[model samples]
Target: MTKQNTFLNDLRNEAITGVAYKNLMLKKQILEYFANISDATITDLSKGLNASIPKINELVVALIEDGLVKDSGKTEVGIGRRPSLYGLKSNSIFFVGVEVKKSHVNIGLSDFKKNLIKSVKRIPFQLTNSQASLDDLCIIIDDFIKSLALAENIAGIGVNLTGRINYKTGYSYSFFHFNEEPLSVIIKDKIGIRTYIENDSRAMAYGEFCSGIVDKEKNILFVNLDYGIGLGIMINGELYYGKSGFAGEFGHIQIFNNEIICHCGKKGCLETEASGSALLEAFKIRLQQGASSIITKDRPDFNDIQLEDIIQAANNDDTLAIELIAEIGEKLGRGIAALINLFNPELVILGGSLSATGDYLFLPVKSAINKYSLSLVNNDTELKMSKLGENAGIIGACLLVRERLLELK
Candidate 1:
């Protein structure tokens, strides 16, 4: 008997012994499939998963009986009896997504079918404000969940924050400043629901991969150009968190040698030149140097000018705003080109607030990539704007709960 033969025999024995386990896994798979898409017929599901129709039908029947799935009428394809469509009973289960920004928090409720139950509620609470405490944070979440009036139905809460989080351990290295206790455990104890935390970029990437416009492509980069830039790398259809879950800090990568210090304590980081914050900062610098723009043309004071105001001006083709955005895009493109060379991703997605700039951003970014990157690396790569828009983070947070928690149970 050889080692390979013994290993093969053990695998054969496990396969024979894992019938019940395999069925449970199959049921979960079917449920997840329904969760990701609108609805699917038994034939479609079987074909999609390449599994036996009888076995899938049997599990779906069990799922229907278990009140997890329901038949959603039928769809006629050609000229026959319509195949029955099934979907998850959305209201039967719920999840909460809390997206914490520096200045505000957006809380949302998602059904089992991954539909936002109501308009996302934005609470004006600052994570950086010293007046707010962990207790206050818990209360806000608890109150938000109570207001939704579906506290009992919620399986778990997912919080996506703009900081470094060891998502595996739920520890926050930036916000909350906790060392001994994971924030998830604290939130769970306070909110009376299972809680999970993730880096906002990672959560958005996961959501994009699972249900957003990315379509689960094997190799892709999701660059979130919000107040600051964050990168989400998906290699081989899985979110790459890297060692210590700090992989997506592309914003902090130093792209220039300058005296300007980033918030991350680095000088001349990509975010220092290309992020929403950096864009606004540059606009302010230009304003002080007596440069004029439609952004501050009607403003009470240049100090009151905002990033959105500049974005609006750019959308309307204000020369200064458009030029500034183009400049930022060029710098961002250089950084992205470096990433392309390293990762050789098939797709690079521009997401978050700055992505909304449309052509004002894309044209310059494309030009910079063409100039900076090797033709071989970027020729096949496609650049796209996120279809999920600002909802990416919230949707990702909601889905993360299901990805990390519900499936475990």
Candidate 2:
């Protein structure tokens, strides 16, 4: 090759390497700053990241070009020059989230900043024989994207399922039908967008982690108590999927000594005694036996009784309702105590529909933990309610897309 050509190629290679290194360093800084505060000024970001002013400026310009950050206009000051404030862009790109539960299906569209722009829910979307329902979910997602007028700008789609997921091959053993023929590939093909899937509980924990709730503490546990129980563990500030992606299947762990059958066909499982379904069953048995409870009197259809109803009944000081919730809470505490002993997490966050009962559930859980757990382990762990609320799954789904895109680039 000619010397001139070789020199030009070397220069190009150096430029490419320089850009890659700068982008990598800037990404680390941007993530750290975003985690520390929701937003920051370029000067503040430079100071926090310990980058030179020119380097920070170059990084900010590159991020803006990539549509990940935006200038929100200059901050007004009483003195000299106005400093520009840059923040993570909210809507330059979009992501789709599909939450699959036994009772319902929820689809949401969110921006880069994990803000829910639009959402839809379909209840009792049968999981047993539900191909049509799945197809409908695809249609709803397509419609939502079209509504946003950014169909081409969509980053990817993410689905959250309530079972063990194989992140490598995108297979789920718990939801076997969707395995091998992984939901990610299927949805990607059907919707003509990049797709990803994760276990629902893990996704919720990711949402909490990305939201700056669980910080560098690394080891944390998140328990979700809704129709059934779900658990998510984060180690080293990342989701810890054990061998076969079944690390956090806390619901099926046996809590009762008796041989009561669980949904997973296991006997004496935690879900059999402590989940919302378990509480509802207990309420029904009490009602049928002529036990006086406001739930039975107010809502005759036991099937119609929701966790919210139970919480409301408890709030109203319904004697039997309070007793039933407390019982479930106590059982849940026993199960959580076992987890605490085994995992010894720094934080344990209670989430899902049942968690909305707040202290009605927490008080009993605390009592049971005190009864069962060792004092040192119990003392170190902070048990708190999820701040993300019902939106955790959706936010996590969006983050999944962003995370994958970053990895790919």
Candidate 3:
């Protein structure tokens, strides 16, 4: 290396914390190594980074002093002395991750180790409230922080919104708005905590990949079929956020020229036919047509029917409920077939509340995929349900905050 660069590196090494490193790139590289691997030793880090043992040791010492990495006792080898194992200091700092849905918002907290320090708190609220929605969100978050006394330790808040979000710019174009100011700044001002926002689908994909669920899979598509359909794309083991940070709007894909109007103001979108709300609407229509079912026995008014009611009834072998789920699954598979042809992902993971229906939904989905997808693309893709489920967004948001913190100088 050049003398000036080397001198700068040496000078910066001793003058910065993990959260704000002078040799930021090197420090971030070391932290990323520990973040990806569990219980690594200094020897492992040196080998992993392809650097000298002495240099790696020096950086490790700096990290240890900064309270970022900690010693985890020792690892034993065959007939040899134990080597000290190091890992992230999981509790050194904390983050709050919030998932905003149409009907409610869910918040959770995690530490550096990605451990869920607090159970998620769900608050019922309407997103259409706009500025009032931000008010309600701040109130809940403020109460949560005060209740746990975590105001001092938290580094920032991450919000996963189920709307069009420009993650790089920290703006939710479709959800939260504050006089055109960035949502992150508005949130920080109101909640008294630095905040970042991402699209929910991207967050879920990130959470699953980083949280060790699909850690081994390089290319995958995470399908979240909740109230609406959302896709999280992982390509070559990295989350692919398109130039606009809005690539995963799989729900808005126009599939047919039907009269059904989508919330996106388009007609015959995938979400209108295959989402949780879609399933509920179809079930309500069936009930209105006098199709006999236990749901109708309890909720004679179709407006009273919920998605959970259909899932429960389907599990109990209710014919109407099972049929509705199967229909939605078939429609969902058509949309997914297009994704398979486009991305050719190795794994397609189905998540969200509707996915819990299991075989009742997946069977039809697979059938449709087989009928629609090219054999070459279909043969290599393995479809499975998301292991992360509801916690995917929350976990993803917390990890994102840690990633952002590591980028500081």
Candidate 4:
């Protein structure tokens, strides 16, 4: 009754007595409000939540005692005295973000205010289709938690992974299929914290949305131009999950006529020609065809050239790199034009590694959208790059841990 018995005493006790159970639901609502709005006065909370002023004030006092809320400062009220403003305590609770890639993992910690407080990038680990790999992944997360050396107030963890994922059930139909338990449960069992799994692209898009940099648009299409193309859709400020949570496979859209097989076991997918891998492939093919690039050099050391090298070369004014990237952008834009016609989204955000090319990529995409989609539709969809860039996945994973744990995701 000294600590946690204050805010989240026991819901099971509600069956026999109504001491603390009922307040848990109300506290959750207030916590969610603070998570979104940052700070509020008691009077503002009363009016916004449509509750009595006394009740709101009591909860605010309780939250402060629980170390979750604090008096941020005072706000002017145009009268003699200023009103006190309450906000979330930045370090009261924490969320961890884990992004898994084929070659490495990205891990980070975020404070209650969604600011990334710590992170380790590109940790060397191979993601393979084996139980050892998944076990190693769990060990990696355990080690990260041990290294925190902070108070044990972690509320949740969010894992960002690729391929078909059921964010709702935490079951990944793709990787880690070797486990009988859902992927989230497996990680949670190891870390002893509630865990949530999400599609990597969707996590990135959500990061952009929560960053408050998308002009607060209600409708958005986030095109992830990573090693493989992906899409994340936000309709009416909510992440859209189709029947089975396989909603945003924008890369697999059949827009070309070729014999190339996609990772998803389909042919002529958009990603086969417009993703980071596609760009790399195009660069190599062009080099073999005698096209000039500073990175390619005399022998076209294909294995030596990385996607980053290509992007840097383009920024350095390498003609061949720019040409290949622009070509891929045009094709990608052609596919995106069809999306604009259908969704009529207010904004389209380009994210992931390949988006780093800046205008070398966006200009051609803009031109293609103008030419392909109807003027009314294309004009409505504004284009921009994600402010978070490569950090989006890690940031989004951390934010989503709070959101989904609070049932907001």
Candidate of highest lDDT: 4
lDDT of 3 by residue, 210-277 (tens): 77467578998999888899998988877788898888899999997788999899999998888888
TM-score winner, 1 or 3: 3
- Each candidate's number of clashing pairs is 0, 0, 0, 0
State the TM-score for model 1: 0.81
* Residue-level lDDT tens digits of model 1 in 1-409: 3123221122223354466667766776787787665589998889887899999899888778656789988786757788898988867667888888765677788877678776454576757623255666788789888888757667788998886888889888878865467888888888878789989888888778776888647898999888899888888987898888888899998898888889989798988888999899888888889888876658859788877688888888788888999999999999999999999999998887788889899999999999999999899898888888778888889987877654621
lDDT of 4 by residue, 203-243 (tens): 99889998835876989999988778889899998888899
Alpha carbon lDDT of each predicted model: 0.80, 0.76, 0.80, 0.84
Arrange candidates, best lDDT first.
Answer: 4, 1, 3, 2
TM-scores for the candidates: 0.81, 0.78, 0.85, 0.88
Model 1: how far residue 147 lies from native, Å: 2.2
- Lowest summed lDDT across 10 adjacent residues in model 2 is found at 2-11
Worst 10 residues of 4 by lDDT: 8-17
Candidate 3 pairs with clashing backbones = none
Quote the positional error of residue 327 for candidate 4 in Å.
1.4
The alpha-carbon lDDT assigned to residue 283 of candidate 4 equals 89
Tell me each candidate's RMSD, in Å, in order: 8.8, 7.2, 6.0, 3.4
- Residue 186 of model 2, lDDT score: 75
